[model samples]
Target: MVKIYGHPFAAFYWKVLIALHERNVPFEFLMLDADHPQHGEAVARLSPTGQFPVLIDADHVVIESAAIIEYLDLHHGHAPPMVPADPRAAIEARQMDGIFDDYVMAPLSRMVFNALRDTDKQDPHTITVAQGTLDKSYA
Candidate 1:
């Protein structure tokens, strides 16, 4: 069975979980929190950036949500691929993915991370910029 190392709160990680559910793929969700030291260690060892949502399948270790999703679609033999099979449709899908990541999620992630920081430690300027980006993206 495939194992995914991630925290439930992570936005990027949620995409992988959604994909797995959509395809009816069975995977173990390895929670990476204070309680799961071993899972955290495994993720730190496998992921290049020590990031969450690392997918381990047999001997293969896949990092990055997009790559992991693509790997699943290709290797898991699911009913319908998350990405379209058609050339033009695939390109458009990929483009939309890039746009969402860069314009929407990037700033949103920045804001979320900033919110997690201590009240005084958080950078107001950064939050302002992120909010501005989000506003533009939404518009």
Candidate 2:
């Protein structure tokens, strides 16, 4: 059985869940939160960065949201692959994924992280830069 270690609120983790559901795959969810210290510790061992959304299939351990999604599609998907089989199409798909991750998600994540920091510890410069990136990406 496949086991996924992640939190529901995390976008990267959520992406993997959506992919699994879309492929009609059955798996176990190991949430990483205060109540699940063991799950977090397991992730700390499985992932280099101790990040969530790590997929454990048999003896294989996969980390990174994009990589995990591709792994699921290649190993478990039935018909059409999540990423196109065609070289050109695949490149385009990956390109867009990168754009979203870099321009949209990264900035949004930075803003959110900053928001979580204490007011005195928060970096206005970082928030401003992230906001600029978001604005440019949206434009």
| Pairs of residues at least 3 apart in sequence or in different chains that clash in candidate 1 | none
Q: Any idea what lDDT model 1 has?
A: 0.87
Model 1 off-target regions past 4 Å? none
lDDT of 2 by residue, 14-121 (tens): 878888988888999998889988888898888999877899999999998899989988999575777788999999989988888899988998899899999999
Clashing pairs in 2: none
Off by over 4 Å in 2: none
lDDT of each residue in 1-113, candidate 1, tens digit only: 99998888888899889889988899988889999799988988898798878999999999988888889999884669988889899899789778777888889889888
The clash number for model 1 is 0
**Model 1 root-mean-square deviation:** 1.2
